[model samples]
Target: IGVGTCIMILSLLVEAYGGYLLTHPPFSVPYYYVLIVTEESLEMIGTSCVVGGILYAMRRVSKERLKFS
Candidate 1:
């Protein structure tokens, strides 16, 4: 549970950073192409991780339940 929560929080931070880069490109860079690509990739990866963690946690919980006959 703790690990999952930590992963989710880290994912959120990565997503936010990517968003910021997308919206505000560095001045030294003439083109924003790299920023766009990086942002998209980061967002996709972050979302995947978050979803995977949630599904894993859910499965773990469900599997732990005792069955009553």
Candidate 2:
């Protein structure tokens, strides 16, 4: 969960940088497009991690309850 949150924050920063670059780009147009792609990819990966973490926690809790029963 913490890892996912960090990634999400990082992606947000990347997106903000991209927005800033729109007016003051240091590189070519293609580079900005690439940055956009990277930002989107990061967001997807972060979401997956959060979901995976939730599933793992749920499984662990279920296993503990089963043992008690």
Candidate 3:
């Protein structure tokens, strides 16, 4: 959770300073960069993270239950 929180904070900071959607004269982002090619790519990345986390948590919970049983 701590790691995920850190990562989310960093992403927000990057988006805030780097660029924003529906803005004029594209903001000149510096210091760091992320190669996001398209909108769908970003959606895919988020969806993959959520699905993976859910699956991982389910597996962990089932394993712990098995041990108790």
For each candidate, the alpha-carbon lDDT, in order, equals: 0.62, 0.91, 0.54
How does model 1 fare in lDDT? Answer: 0.62
Residues 1-69 of candidate 1: C-alpha lDDT, one tens digit per residue: 455455556656666655666677564353345555555565566667777878998888888895556
Q: Spell out the clash pairs found in candidate 2.
A: none
Off by over 4 Å in 3: 1-37
Clash counts for the predictions, in order: 0, 0, 0
Tell me the TM-score of each prediction against the true structure: 0.55, 0.87, 0.46
Rank list by lDDT: 2, 1, 3
Per-residue accuracy of model 2 over 11-36 as CA lDDT, tens digit each: 99999989888878476899889999
Mind sharing the TM-score for model 3? 0.46
